[model samples]
Target: MSLAVALEVTPLPLRHPLPTPPPHHVGQPPTAFHNPWPSFHQHSWLDALLTSRRNRDFKPVPPRDQLVKIVRPEWGNGQDGLKATWIGHASFLIETPKQNNNEGGGRGVRILFDPVFSDRTSPVSWAGPKRYTPTPCTLAEVPEVDVVVISHDHYDHMDAETLQPLYERRKGKINFLVPLGNAVRLHGMGIAMEDVTQLDWWEGVQVTVPTAGSVKLTCTPSQHFSGRALWDRMSTLWSSWVLECVNTSTTATAPGPASPLRLFFSGDTGYRYVPSEATEDTVPVCPAFGEIGEEYRPFDLSLLPIGLYSPRHFMSPVHCTPEDAVCLHRDLRSKRSIGMHYGTVRGGISQYFEDVTEPPRRFREACETAGMVWGKELALLNVAETVVVRLDLPRLADLDLEHVRSSKHTKYFGIILDLFDASLKKTLERLRLNTNSFSATLCPSLSLLAQMRKSSAK
Candidate 1:
């Protein structure tokens, strides 16, 4: 299907405009943008350089043998449960659970986030922050995608080398969702304006996939600056995103009523700023996260950044430490979270101080301290690893009595009876009930017992 014909976009109106104008439009000419919160602080270049030089002794890259294991993705025609594949760094491919299509077949919607597959994250590829770890899979290995979401214009998160070819390969069949001021860049990549949807924070758009069901993508706030070049720092907007499955099919053959899935992507954000001379608790944190949690709490899954936060005084304003990531997980009320934006690349100079493997270790420890289980509640997945969660299951109420009475479904009914018998035994044991006495009381009528015995014999 044509890109325009395959995707339908509907703008979601906000209840009210933000109290303060979005940071990207704070100035009249809008030459630059700024973090709106008062607690955000940006250090001078000289201080950052001096700190980087002082902390050069630590290992910034792991040995080849210690690198994350890469696995080939198995998408299964996108008809499975909700699946997310980590493509290294901040890139992820998220597929919703199977939903019925117009052709009477089942398919799932696929969304790609901030794909950067270039060797170097820089304006020019020859000299910059080269990837210490390689992409889990090549661009060609990635399955067909329906939507591409860009968080910002930062080199590490957004690479022209990746986006251009990705757009071309899809033949502009992909709908691109990006923060405000980013459409111009996609246009330069040969993407048509109609295929791109730019949204400000709090604004959302419902996208209808021609083959699959619909999803809602919302541009949410992030405490970070954006720029690919020195002169144009913060000229574009940066944001996190909330993706929600809206309309899944509820056919009679489906497992049960459609249960929507909600996912949060913390593109790159700081939970709270930490200064060299001050402790973290004394400083104020960006209130956007708390507000986000209140607005969209209880996410089924969340992808949170958890690395490149060394030289805390400088990096804490933009990057989240592993501990900070744990805090964000709680604030967002996520059921499960996976760490990202770490272990993939190290900058030439800027983010070279932190030990390469420290993020996941710290993340585990922090989750433990917060009374959360490591793999159960929050985790750091191996690169290219795929995680799947089933969102719909058959409930007791969903069982059709008439269908169960039919001869074709008698075997299923028998299985259900076996399950009920096992459960009743467990419940009786837990309650310390006398099985014989309970059975006698339950069937007190002798006539009913005789009738049941006669029916069984017959």
Candidate 2:
């Protein structure tokens, strides 16, 4: 079978998925995700360099030796757990709890996301945005990384310098998941094709993690462009990922419904359009995030990009502002969200005119504006700081019931559609009359469904 078929490709619902660039481009495919706004023309590098030449206000000082201990995962138990360690920028060491407490079962599966450890996030060693802070730990220091997830082909997100050493340390045992168009890049970097699984938007695959049972990985859409070089801009795809880990067997014959812990990694994204900039012609649509929440609500934890936004006209179309990140947190319906993609590298337009620390401050202000309590509803971790959270697993009965309900769609299909349909004025009006019963009906299952219905009715 072809690689696309092998990867179980599921085309996104986008009217136009990729860009329609000029004719001369050979390597760039039409499958890339497109930005509906006018095509982006990057600012002149010379102008940017000249603008930022002497501006280094509030440049962060490197952190002291406050190190987070890296632990090798013990997979296979049902005891649920979740831990995240921020290395720097978008790099994170995410650990899912083991299902079993048995001595040999293991701790859990460990994953690395957008891991860039090089001194610079550029092609050349001497010139580029130099690292402001040291890596929390070297690639070799990270325990056996069962999976390495790359959001896109940007140098900051996909550093071959880090991947090479990591592959050598793991002896090429790590399964690398990347965007569909990135296989050739990994292959060129000496990573084997068989060891990599490339996916498009909405496509997913299940990989067994030795003693850790199964983890379902889905390559979801991100509203961002990709290309390591200027010439190859938008040639490859960029994406966010959903990693769901289950301690118990996920097979049809498994004795009970397994509670799975979900982690939504918001690779790097920006809003489709700023709410203020949106007009009647553009309804401010970002279908992917809403669909993601519909299918995978109550994410145990989420890592969202909250930086690189400034000079709103140019960056707002590509990089998310702190407010946009807050909107995404609510869209994803995450239990907790953390800010990323800031403070380590300085290349975005913001650095020229805005302080490097502005992103986090904006993030705090946005969260407070939305009535979300910081440190509880969302968090901002320092470099190398690790936070461990125990997840409350969904009941086996709820899991099984959802499956059964989904299978028998005809039974409640009409009512579901009517309740959620904005055009059905009478149906929504009726829903408000019995909020308690409606909420209770979906309480043990899709409680959010009821909440959405009530909110809409109001």
Local distance difference test scores for all models: 0.71, 0.63
lDDT (0-100) at residue 94 of candidate 2?
A: 79
lDDT computed for candidate 1: 0.71
Error of 1 at 422 (Å): 20
Across 1-458, the per-residue lDDT of candidate 1 in tens digits comes to: 33334567899877326756555475764556677776578766687668878856666465777766665555433335667778899999988766664442356678999999999999897988888888867898887788899999888888889888888877646789998889998898788888899988899988777776678889998889887766777888899999887744665555544646678999988766678634765566676765676577557688999988877877888988877786676566566788999888887344556788788888888777654556656777677766665543433221111101224322111112122334323432332222123221121122332233234333
Each prediction's RMSD to truth: 13.6, 10.9
Give the per-residue Cα lDDT of candidate 1 at 343. 85
Report residue 355 deviation for candidate 2 (angstroms): 1.0
Task: Flag regions of model 1 displaced more than 4 Å.
Answer: 1-5, 28-31, 76-79, 101-104, 251-259, 348-351, 393-458
lDDT of 2 by residue, 1-458 (tens): 11111122122333224345522224445545554333223445575565455443444433533222223332212323566778888998877766663233565666889999999988989998887666756666666676789999988899999887776666445678898789888988988887788886767777655544456778887778788876877777788999887565444545554667678998888664442444312335455676576577657678998887765555665677777676667667665688888877777556565556678888888777655557655667667655555533432322110011123221110001111234334322343343234221111112343344445545
